[model samples]
Target chain A: MVTRPPVIAEWLVRQTAPADMREALLGDLCEEFVLRGSPGGRRWYWKQALVSAAQWVPASLLLLLPGYLLPLWLLDRLWALLLSSIPLKEDAVRAWPMLAINLVVACLLGAAVRLPSGALVLGAAVLILAASVRLPLDYCCLFLVLPALASKWPARKVKRV
Target chain B: MKEYLGEFEQLVMLALLRLGDSAYGMSVRREIEARTGRDIAIGAVYATLDRLEGKGMVASKTGEATEDRGGRAKRMFLPTAAGLSALQASREAVARMSQGLELEGLVW
Candidate 1:
């Protein structure tokens, strides 16, 4: 009986890896996994895969910055315009517009980038923004959840491979 | 001014020189680990290789797929003449820095 590396761990590495290097990288990991043997091999594989995936995060987050920041700035301007026309005395009600705009922009950016790390960064940014505006903890989570879901949006262009 | 190899880059290029034809990612990584006893990340290995290739210090080709590797082709790498020069330059620089230092048993 042949033992296999953990499937989900392999899938995560494949999904997160840059396209050009994917084949060779996965092949190396697979070969090393076999040589390392079972149980401990799985752990080692997971550790390597996770570390590799993490290296992509800083680049992905940097790529996402302009996409996230510009829209957020525009949304802030629109929210200011709306606040002038709509008067809300309660602090809770005042926080709602800020939270809503943050969620909307983060989701849009997350969908546009289509990278898992992009989604995570945008989601975390939204959560932080929501919390700053004093939204309830339950509502703050929505700021995180929506962008992650929106990250699965349909691709605008089909990849050649 | 001539560019010199960093410590890890020198190690990698030397490994390539030692490995000759069989120098691919896994083999190079294992060679470094065996000699240095350092736990090197595969991603770091590839990233360095890519950078070295970009600088024309290294070249690579795709080798045949193998069953042990789940039918994924290996990327074989070899040092260029430029790579050898850079490695030599780095070694000379280190030697110059250490010249006439009366430090015995400094190496751990």
Candidate 2:
């Protein structure tokens, strides 16, 4: 017996087109796939990724500017200290190279927000946060909050008079 | 006024006619694939169908959902009078264009 109609699969594949139009279709597919594959795991992954990205990126960078700055500065200092402790330390190493690299990466990540590949960047950030962080809850919060807010922020509509 | 249909649009309308009143998104898609052996996208079919419907060449209604389709109602299509006329005109045009063509020496 022929199982499900070939058309359904063909239809689903066709939905992945027009480049711009593919995101919503793919998003829905991803959602459905996750729901079917592992409901609990998907829920946790979404909670961490979407929810945290939405929260942290804005709350830290935009809303609480000073608070965010303090934490980032501290983190940078700690990273510098950790790097300094390594045996291959030279004066050039302790200089502005690490800070410049961080800045460049941050800029690239920000620029990626406008591209279609932003999803990949967001996914990577979520995965990195999830794996490396000690406080799972905080990482999850940041991952979910930042991307969600960034993605959904309403574009300013120009009134065509 | 003969509005030119794209190749895919022609294929879809022809498929719908062949499918009769049973023509819907999934069925039409399957018919096209089976007949033409072309892998078509579902979004393209729906989008084109919606355009054709807007042009008054086709009409559609939502049909009962089935268990296998995740409870999604199928959108059924039927060719309007204009649609049939368009198909006939397109067929005649193609026939007229290829009338005297000789393919004996052409590579098979």
Candidate 3:
């Protein structure tokens, strides 16, 4: 790594965008980072990272909202129906199926929202694992069912030749 | 009617348009910085470019990786038809709206 960006900032950008875009964006940032390799270059890099995250993260969340809501509404209704019909105990046996359902819904919502699965997985894992010490399975399902919340390039469309 | 772009969006599109064939992520950022003298984050620019592309206002293609960028390809941005039209329209709208403003003492 002759000239590299801050590792964490690069990681964050990688997680924010699609895989295909990561290299280009990181390269751009690194090029600038190298160019600004004066006394405050590291500070400048961090400033750019924080400001950029501030600008994008909220907007990306807004963009993902519509795609997320429809799936969530449908999933919630289905979960309700399942709960009413099947009054199973709150154990791993019941939890596993719900978790699986959440994962599927999460993936679908991820695709619908144009968020990569890697981001969705990373976000949910953090939310679930970090809070697992104090949270129960059903509670953790909330995080699991969430769509990926980051900016991404438009999904490719198919055109008939 | 479609919504008009914010100030930053217009600047970005203008940069891409101005850059022509050379409009990649870093170049666009530099264009904005040099022209406006306002420091901007490259991530923020990429994020907004991503959004514009989402709206079909801007499009991108991957060019060959260059040695200077650590073997990473450049994601070049170009304005779509809709983007150019939006930018033109937005400029015209602003000109129309500010046609009679008393700006004799304000910052240019």
Candidate 4:
């Protein structure tokens, strides 16, 4: 009988994988989980999930910066001007709009970053910082794992014959 | 100069060649582990495959859902003609690079 894989690992994959890829990728993980078929295998699965995340997440974010930074920076300045004019009295409430922008940007970052937990957390922090300053996070950049972030790319033709 | 496959990409492709028609993410990972004694993450494998697919070096098909995988379908992979050609080119490049090297005493 196949034992259940670790919850956190599964959750990590679900959180980051592209919708088009989720089912198949999860199936692959589960298939492996069954093949190893032991408690140690569950640990093995967790290690795989975390390790992959560790390697890819920050790397993707960093790799894309050269291509993204210029545009994002300029746009951010314009956004700051827009936000500044609507200033609230308190820093706390002022922070809310940034936080809101950060969270939305963070979620969008999550959608594109197929790297696991560590990457997810790091991506969120980076986006939050960027968004707080009215900067943009480039969700479209595909530095290393180009395919993971290119689910919506019209050019990616996956022929299944 | 021809593009060289990354070490892991070459390994995954070689694994696909061995697995033949049954190649999917799970078997490919196990095959590599068995042969190379390296524990690779499934995500890493898929990421590479996805990139390869993007590059038109690999192709995949989604198979019927299986109970063992909790009703999730498998994404089976196979090397494309270009993929095989690239692999061979990479292998030849490695051989060409090592052709005249004198390595008899390099290792202790």
Candidate 5:
């Protein structure tokens, strides 16, 4: 059996100072560490962000990619008209534009997941654009609803015996 | 009254007191771990030592670079008069707190 390091817990505890002034000091240190992205702390943040992106990319590809692609694949004539109606000719427009939009949306989604408050403003902008385009309600809802629902689920709940 | 030294601070000071002129980061860390069975992180130990030195409770000087530590110079520490006094006062306080308590047969 492997014995736990005696000082490991203490060191971890010391990392998060007391509930008094020291707590504020440690908080400041953490904030500075994040902002500076120093060698000591940046690796952990990068690892976490990459893990979050790994979860997010697959989900976005599954959910949004199908919706975005199915319109072009199944309703090719209607999709051409939709593109032409936006004041851009079908042939003048390239698949690159749609891909670019998807990439931007993915980046925005990643940012929203990482920073919720900032993402709220971006979400509002997307909602306005979606409304202008008269896009399906579910499309608009996907951006706002999913994130809100995910945020509401408590990580751990306590129950009284 | 002087503020109470934290447990890690107390440990580092005590190690310096015991090691006298030979107190350095690795040696002091090893000494504390041997005595207390606490495997402290090197970063935490160095940070605490920096704080203690800042408070003038300990004094440190850079020694010659060594091969084992990637050719890094060792920072040797020695307890100041204030450190010794602080350690003595902390010990006395603990002793006073336990003076009347019969802890012999207690589970604690």
Candidate 6:
């Protein structure tokens, strides 16, 4: 009888794992899961999944940090420049451009970090985090949606062979 | 002077040496856990393996896929000459540091 590991756990591992090592890592986990049997194996699988996600998520975040932040900074400067030139007050009325800028940045960042196993979830989480601090409802929704949309483009794919 | 291997890297290399042809992720993790009684994560093993490979201290080959592993191929690793020498240097460095040293509660 073939005993399988937890589906969600396996998916988590597959999603967050570095592409180059994903196959071997998954194989190791599966083999071990079989060896340990179902009772304790399921729990062990979840533990490994969490541990692996912990390792990869931090590394991915660090690598994507500059990719995400630099664009935001540049666009913020541009927004400031626009406000200064147009004689517009830096109030809610003037904030629409900032929202637009954030959406563009979010899309670029999502594309930059998109992985094979649906890592747009990570992008969405990051966007929501940024949104939580300063964005209003409409801006937050756009921030959330744009990344998920941009992640679909095949041009910016980052998968390994 | 050769660069010294970190403690975990040394363990991974030693495990590779012990496993010989079967020095893949699962076996390596099991070998270390059985001997050291430390619960080693497979992810940690692969990360260290990748780092070792990056440093040219190890080389790996993609092995045949097995049904037990859901048809996923094994990536087998072996320590390089540099890895062996680095492990030796690390061991010697520790041994030299501990030479003729005795703690208050322990006898040599």
lDDT of 2 by residue, B8-73 (tens): 889999999899877776567679989889866555676577667768888766566554444555
User: Per-residue lDDT tens digits of candidate 1, residues A61-156?
Assistant: 565455554565567678867887877676745544576757676676656566333354455766776688786786667646764564455533
Candidate 2 chain B: worst-modelled 10 consecutive residues by lDDT: B65-74
Tens digits of per-residue lDDT for model 6 on A1-161?
A: 44988899998887677666788899989999999997799889999999878887777656445555456556767887887678655563654557766666656665666623335555666676767687556644653455346434453222121
iRMSD of all candidate structures: 5.4, 12.1, 4.0, 1.6, 17.8, 4.2
TM-score of chain B of 5: 0.88
Model 4 per-residue lDDT tens digits across residues A86-152? 8577654543234335334443554454322233444454555556666324432211123233333
What overall lDDT goes with each candidate model? 0.75, 0.52, 0.68, 0.68, 0.50, 0.76
Please, what are the lDDT tens digits per residue for candidate 2 over residues A1-161?
A: 22232333324332223222233333333333344455543443343333323433332233222322234345557767877677763554444325544444433454343322123234345546455645345434444444333334332221211
CAPRI accuracy category, model 1: acceptable
Backbone clash pairs for candidate 3 read none
- lDDT: the better of candidates 2 and 4: 4
TM-score of chain B of 1: 0.93
Model 6 CA deviation exceeding 4 Å by range: A79-95, A98-121, A136-161
Indicate whether candidate 2 or candidate 6 has the larger TM-score: 6
Best by TM-score: 6
* Top lDDT hit: 6
| Candidate 2 Cα deviation (angstroms), residue B45 | 1.7
Sorted on lDDT, highest at the top, how do the candidates line up? 6, 1, 3, 4, 2, 5
- In the range A1-161, model 5's lDDT, one tens digit per residue, is 21121233223323222211122222322332344454644543333333433333344344333433333233445445566567656567444224334434544444444422112223344456567777656556545543333233232121111
Spell out the clash pairs found in candidate 4.
none
**Pairs with backbone N, CA or C atoms under 3 Å apart (clashes), candidate 5:** none
Worst 10 residues of 3 chain A by lDDT: A152-161
Separately for all candidates shown, the number of backbone clashes (residues 3 or more apart, or on different chains) is: 0, 22, 0, 0, 0, 0
- Candidate 2 residue runs with Cα over 4 Å from true position: A1-161
Model 1, global lDDT: 0.75
User: For residues B1-108, what per-residue lDDT tens digits would candidate 6 score against the true structure?
Assistant: 688999999999999999999899989999999999999999999989888887778888888898879899998888888889999999999999999998678966
Q: Is candidate 1 or candidate 4 better by lDDT?
A: 1
Instruction: List TM-scores for all candidates, in order.
Output: 0.67, 0.43, 0.72, 0.71, 0.41, 0.78
